[model samples]
Target: MLLRRRRFPILQHLGVFSNPRSFLLHPLHSPQYSSSKRNREQLLNSMRDLKTVDAALDFFNKMVAMNPFPSVKDFNCLCSIVVKMKHYTTAISLIKRMHSLGVKIDSWTLNIVVNCLCRLKRTVFGLSILGLMFKIGLEPTVVTINTIVNGLCVEGNVEQALGLAERIENMGYESDSYTHGAIINGLCKVGDTSVAIGYLRKVEKRGCKLNVVAYSAIMDGLCKDGLVPEALGLWSEMTGKGIQPTLVTYNCLIKGLCDFGRWQDAAILLGMMMKKGIMPDVQTFSAIVDNFCKEGMITRAESVIGFMVRMGVEPNDFTYNAMINAHCLQNQMKEAMDVLDMMVRKGCLPCTVTYTSLIHGWCKIKNMNKAMSLLCEMINKGLSPNICTWNALIGGLCKVWKPLAAKELIFTMQKHGQLPNLRTYAIILDGLFKCNFYSEAISLFRALEQMNLDRHILIYSIVLDGMCSFGKLNDARELFSCLPAKGLKINVYTYTIMIKGLCKEGLLDDAEDLLMNMEENGCPPNACTYNVLVQGLLRIYDILRSAKYLQLMKGKGFSADATTTELLISSFSGIKGENAFQEFLQKLVGV
Candidate 1:
């Protein structure tokens, strides 16, 4: 044993001493040193294979447990992982936790959270976070301010965002291109084009560079608000300033020109865009196509579609739908269906409006079965029919005097959670009246009143006419009385219906009062009112009032027809030889 101890080499002793276990046992290596080494290894491994927020959070928990303190970089990485996962609430919670633990957060980390909050539509909470950052002696960078301003601007709160931008400038932070662009975009979005232009001038005065996006935003806003000339001037200014128009810029101008009915000018602009190496986009083609269709130039519209396909620009659903509507309007059903088939072949799905247009076309031809079949096909294709489609079907049914079918269609609409509009109710009511379904007509009229939709005087007149025809003059009078309380001034049709109802009932006194009221309300009676009244008075043997009305009718440039002369002569049958009555009758017949 003594010989072995003497024979051990110093190299072996150094090797034994360099082992980690031996170092731990040595006085030079404390327990803290071993623990720190273990923690560092774990932290390195965590950073190497990190993928999700949960793993990052677990690693962060272990790190804080090991050291009881985290660096700013460690806290930022954890928060970034949370933001990347869109766990905004959890990210905010981590920020609060990091603050409580006295971990310093940088401006970049604050901006990340602020942007996440704004993207989540939690801008109020984001502003509070900004205030908290200020309270903790942290300054928001220009980028952070720009994010807040852009969020507010997109939300149409440009004034508040501008105030915040001014505050950022007052804090000695230089506004970058993004900052100015956001403010200009916000102002323009809210229709404050004048302010937006002034701000643009200020940006130029301040020597900040203006990009194409900012100019395009202004141009889009100007065009949207019908300031086409101003927008065109700005476009010229932009080109002169060496900024080329983008696809969006040309699209805005094309759409604006189309909206203002300047189709020829829009075409010229399209040619100019092509010559200037600016390609027209789908929106541009759609605008031109829609304009041609609106002008009833179907040939021109089809030519535009061909031109788009040749240019390698495929039409979108809106483009196809517009052409289909044009074809339907022209009653070219076969062409419309062919376009729909083409749409399907191109892998483009037809929307409800496509089917609705086809249905309307079929309805126009009184082909309700074809319309119904197309509607069923739409439903089977998973395109739900809208109110317009149902309206077309119902209106077509009513047009063909199929009121029962129209009522059935109304029930179907209600089952699908679509209530008929006032127009729908009006058509149904008019149909019922024309079909002599007076009871149903009056019931529908009262139903409209119950639904608070009877304020329209036209609806009242329809019901009154039905009542007069059905000899429900009292009901007509009651409905007429309710019109004024509903704030509906009686129109010419209302007075005519009511006066005719009273005349038919032989109520001459009441009819004359209504006639005076008609004139008082500035609705001068037409020939129909005078003729009906004269016939009523003659039937009741009131020759004096009848002669007065006949004279008034003549004064109003109404010549009594042969029927009127015959009626007057017949009314004086018993008293035909009397002198005064005979003279009056003779004068009326001569006229």
Candidate 2:
């Protein structure tokens, strides 16, 4: 068998008696050649027209059962088509059938098996196949190694991939651009942009060409990390190297700039892309529109939409959502509704976010009917409300002083497999306190405390504010002290609320102490904190102490609030005959 194989190496490689050279040679040289050519062409055309796995399998069965058998190339062509169809296991099965038929395997044929294995995320089996290649005396090609490297990268095994590349190099198989690109992209995806950049430098030193795909991958990673300046610098370097930036490259930079609120810079870059004949796509325009709407630059957002339309780039759902969200945020429901109508007329269907934004807006304006109408519309259109949607409606119900209705909403949420998050609880508690339902708020808080749910500080803050607002001073103080033991970090809001509570009960000294303790505890008082303390002291007619804190507040650049000013004006009204006192009161009010 060895002598015969050695004597007819091409025949062994082909696994058939038909010489591959016959197809390459002139058809006129043999009468049989043109007919063989016709069969080969017809087979290839049949493979090209294969649309389903069953059709491909039928083709494979026919090819393997041919009298002399088709060439290994034809079998490989069939295997590749199956692989493209994502029938990895079926491709492997077909290749296994080839081996069983004693069809001598070539390297390309083996590579297909390895490719299918890797596609299945079984890179370990692919490696075993690689071992089989060496055992069978077949030299694995660059394409084979590149496929494995990409497979490892996809599986987030970057280190192992690098090691494999080194191993291949030692075997006299140098890594190509595809190999380097895969590793660089892998590093970036794993958030090792700095490491990926280092690898890029190594590629430069080794004279391995790094293409725009690799550059774009690293640039995208940098932009996502908010390293926009570094990304832009790299962009300059890539452009300076005469590697023209692709649309993806521009989109990454544009999105990053917009994310960081560099709107003007983003606009300039968009313009630069246009001048360079790289037209901004829908994504590029959408990013600008979304960010502009978020920053409340409605006119600029509108202008971008106009330009996008003029350039014949139709606005997608996100583009319309940005417009709707902007108007919704500003409580301009009529204008938002108008945008919604325009979206519908233009054949751009409104999505869940569109209705959610409108619902949240109407809720903000306390227009529950409008909000509920949109919710019904959203459901009628077969769109399921996400958690944010439920949260918005629950908050809206609570905002309109309807705590019972909000609880009913929560039940409906549960029916839809949605659970109330901590934010939802906080909203309900705040609403209860606002509506003077203190006992009910207490009952809910007590019930939640016994549950295993990880409690959030916001909920505690609402409860604390409730206790303070409704005159539960001693109980609020006890809970405030226990919060530290409960592992809750008392933020400035909690401290300010406590200070106000203490001052409300004529505990001016303790409120002052909390104000001092707040600074000592590293939760420094904001303007609201200072104002709360001052207003509390002024409420108890402690002019001397209040005036001293006013001086301190002024030194810290904290201005008196309107409530504090009103108190100061009222306290000094009877003594207006004294010009010095009047001037001091005016100065305090201004401060």
Candidate of highest lDDT: 2
What residue pairs clash in candidate 1, if any at all?
none
| Deviating ranges (above 4 Å) for candidate 2 | 1-36, 45-62, 82-105, 113-138, 155-172, 198-207, 240-242, 341-350, 369-384, 565-575, 581-591
- Model 1: how far residue 160 lies from native, Å: 4.1
What 10-residue stretch in candidate 1 is worst by lDDT?
Answer: 10-19
After the best TM-score superposition of candidate 1, give how far the Cα of residue 74 lies from its true spot, in angstroms.
9.8
| Cα lDDT of model 2 by residue, 293-393, tens digit | 99999999999999989999999989999999999999999999999999999899988889999999999999999889988988899898888888888
Residue 519, candidate 1: how far off, in angstroms? 12
Q: Clashes in candidate 1: how many?
A: 0
TM-score of each: 0.64, 0.83
Superposed Cα deviation of residue 184, candidate 1 (Å): 4.6
Error of 1 at 314 (Å): 1.0
